[model samples]
Target: MSSGNPTVFRTLNERVALTLLLEHGGLTRAELEQHTGLSKASAAEVLRRLENSGLARKAGLKPGNAGPAAQMWQLDGSAALVAGVDLTTTSIEVSVADLTGRVLGVHTTDATGDVRRLLGETLDAAGFGLDELDQVVVGVPGVVEADGRRVRQAVQLSGWSGLDDLPENVRLENDVNLVAIRELQEHEDSSFVLFWVGGGVGAGVVLDGGLWRGVTGRGGEVGSVIVPDPVTNGRRYGQDGGPLGALLGAEPLAALAEAHGL
Candidate 1:
C-alpha cells in the first residue's frame, strides 16, 4: 500500500522513524531500517530530515565490533514541551514533560484554583513558560460532552465550570479512558475492557484499536450503573440497581466501611 506521493511517504517514514527512536531510546541506521522496513537510503533520508527538523539527533556510535561505526540517532527531548493534568474533585496535579516523556516538572494545586495558572506554575518549575508549552492534555473524571467543550454527568467535578476558554492546543479527556490506553501495550488483543474502581467505577472499552468514547461521551459511565442488592435497601444511591458500584463510590464505600466497624 503505497501513498504514491513522495512527500507523504517521506512524512510517514519520518514519523515511523521517530516512533522507533522514541520507543528504543536510540537506534542505528541499520536498526531503523530493520524496524521501519525502510531501505538503507530511505532510512538515511528520514533520519536526515528528522535531524534537520530538530526532532532527532545523532546520539553516539552503537557498540558494535563489526564493520564501520553506526551512528545511533535519538529523539531530541527538548524539541517540544507538553503538559499532562490529572484533575480531580479536590485537587489538580500537573506534570510538564518533554517529547521523550521525561517529566521536567510537577505542580499540584486545589481543583478550585485556576488550571491555567497551575499550568503556568508547573511550566515555570520546569524552567520554561506557558508560551513554550506546545500542547496540554487534561484528564478529567467526567463525561466530556459537547465536542469536548462541556463536561456533563461528572458527579465528581461538580460546581467548577472548568477552563472552557482554553487555547486550541489544550484537550480534555475522560480519565478512565486514559487509564485504559495502557492496556493496549499489556495485551495484543484489539478489544478489552478496563474497569476503573476506587473513588468511582468506570469502564474503558477498547474496540478496534481505539477507546470507544461513545457518541455523547458517556461510553463508560459504570459508576452510574444500577443493580439489585437485597441486603441494602435504604442505602441505595438511587432506585433501580442490583448490587452495582453506583452506590459504592468513595463516599458510599467509606460509609459502608464505617458501618461495618472496620
Candidate 2:
C-alpha cells in the first residue's frame, strides 16, 4: 500500500518500474503492471514520470491479443554513466559502465602516488570527464566504514586513508564485499561464504540472500581471530599472522605448499 504522500508514492513507483525495465528489457504497460503488481493507472503514471525524466522511453509496439498494439518501454541506458574502480596494492583497475550496466571502457595501471590523479587518468582513458560520471564505486582492499567515509586496515595501499579532493559521488567499498555482491547477484538462491586470500586474508558471508554486515561493518574480519601461537605454545591475538591468517593467508599458504612439495 502506498503512503498518503503522492510524491513519495510516485517516486517509488518510478524506481520499481525502472528496475523492472532494466532487468527484463522492454515491457508493455500491461506487462509492467503484471510484474510490478501495480494498478493500470499507477503503471501509466510511473511510465510517464520515467519518460519525462529521460530515464526511459517507448522502444516499440507490441501486438496485443485482441486490442490495438501496446507501446513497449525500456530504460535509456545512455541517460547516465557510472564507474567502478578496483584499487589493489599493486594495480588499479577502472571500468566505465552505463545505466544498464554495460561496460563502455576498462583501464588498468600500476598503483601510483595520488589516488585522485589516477582516477582522472582512468576517466580520460575511458573517454569521459569527471563531470560526466554520475557515480564512482571504488573497491579498496580493506574495511570501509558503513558511512563510506573512511578505510582502515589497508596498510599495503597507502594514501587511501586520507583521500582528499575525491568527487562527491564517490563510494568506497571493501573488495571482499564487492566480490560478495557479485556472488549474491549471480547466485540468488544460495547463501555462501567467500574467502579472499590475496595480499591479505578476509571472509565475506551472505545469509538468506543478503550480505551479513555485522556491527562496525567488520563482519568478515576472520583473519583477526586469535589462536594458539606456534612459537609461544600459547594463544596470541594477531591480525596479519594470526591462526586463521596463517592457515589461509596467501603468503603463509604458499610457503606451506612449497614446503609440502606440491
Candidate 3:
C-alpha cells in the first residue's frame, strides 16, 4: 500500500537518481535501479523526470552482457556553473568552471570596488554572465569566522566593507586556505601543511585528508606568532611592523631586494 503522496516520493527518487549520476558520471537504467534499489518502473519514472527537468541528459548507450544496448544518462554539466573569486588589495580575478571542474574562462582586473560590481564585470570579461553562476567561492586575505559568515584580519582589504552585501551563494574563505584546498584537490588523501608568503604570511593546515581550520578558521595564522624583531632586539608593537608579519611578509622581502639593488 502507498504510504506517502506519490508526487513527493517521485521527487525524492529523482534527487537520488541525479546524485548517483553525479557520482558515477553516467549510468544506465538498470544500473540506476541496481544502485537505488528501485524497481524498473520507478527508475524509469525518476529518469523521465530528470530528463524533463533538464537535470540529466542521454549520453549514448551502455552495452549489457545479454541484452541490447541500454541508454546511458548523465548529469548535465552545464546545468550549473561555479565561479571562484580571488580578491586582493590590487587585483580581482574571477574564474568560471562547469560542474565537472572544467575551467570555462578566467578574467583578472586591477579594478577594486564593490565586490558584486567587480564580479559582474569580471564575469563579462570571462565570457559569462553573473546570472550564470550557481555558486561563487571568494578567497580574501583574511580568516573566515562563524563558518564563513564573517572575515577578520584582512588589512589589505581595509577599503573593502566585507562580503555581507554579496549573495548567500558567495562564500568567504582565507586566501592561503583556498590554496591549501587546491593542494588537497591535486594531492588527495594526504596530510600536509602549506606556508604562503605574499603581502602577508599565512599557512594552511591539511590533516588526515581534510583541512583543519580551527574553531574560528585561524589555525594557520603563523604571521602573528611574535617572533623577535631583529632590528629592535625587543618587542615590536606599532606601525604594523612588530608582528611576525612585518619580519617575513612581502614588504620586508621587497625592502631587502631593493636594499641589495636586486
Candidate with best TM-score:
1
**Each candidate's lDDT (Cα)?**
0.77, 0.81, 0.83
Those runs of model 2 whose alpha carbons end farther than 4 Å from true positions after fitting are: 1-3, 65-67, 159-164, 186-191, 227-241, 254-262
Count of residue pairs whose backbone atoms collide, per candidate: 7, 0, 1
TM-scores of the candidates in the order shown: 0.86, 0.85, 0.70
Model 2: per-residue lDDT, tens digit, 64-181? Answer: 8898999999989999999999898777789999998889999887766678887888789878887789999888877777867667567668744345347788888888888999
Candidate 3 displacement at residue 205 in angstroms: 1.9
Off by over 4 Å in 3: 1-53, 63-67, 186-190, 228-244, 250-262
User: Which 10 consecutive positions of candidate 1 have the poorest summed lDDT?
Assistant: 229-238
Positional deviation of residue 46's Cα in model 1 after best superposition, in angstroms: 0.6
Better of 1 and 3 by TM-score: 1
Model 3 / residue 100 / CA error / Å: 2.1
Taking the tens digit of each residue's C-alpha lDDT, what string does model 3 give over 156-186?
8876663677777778889898899988977
Report the lDDT tens digits of candidate 1 across residue range 29-59.
9899889788888888888999999999989
lDDT of the structure predicted as candidate 1: 0.77
- TM-score order of candidates, top first: 1, 2, 3
Which residue pairs in candidate 3 collide? 236-242
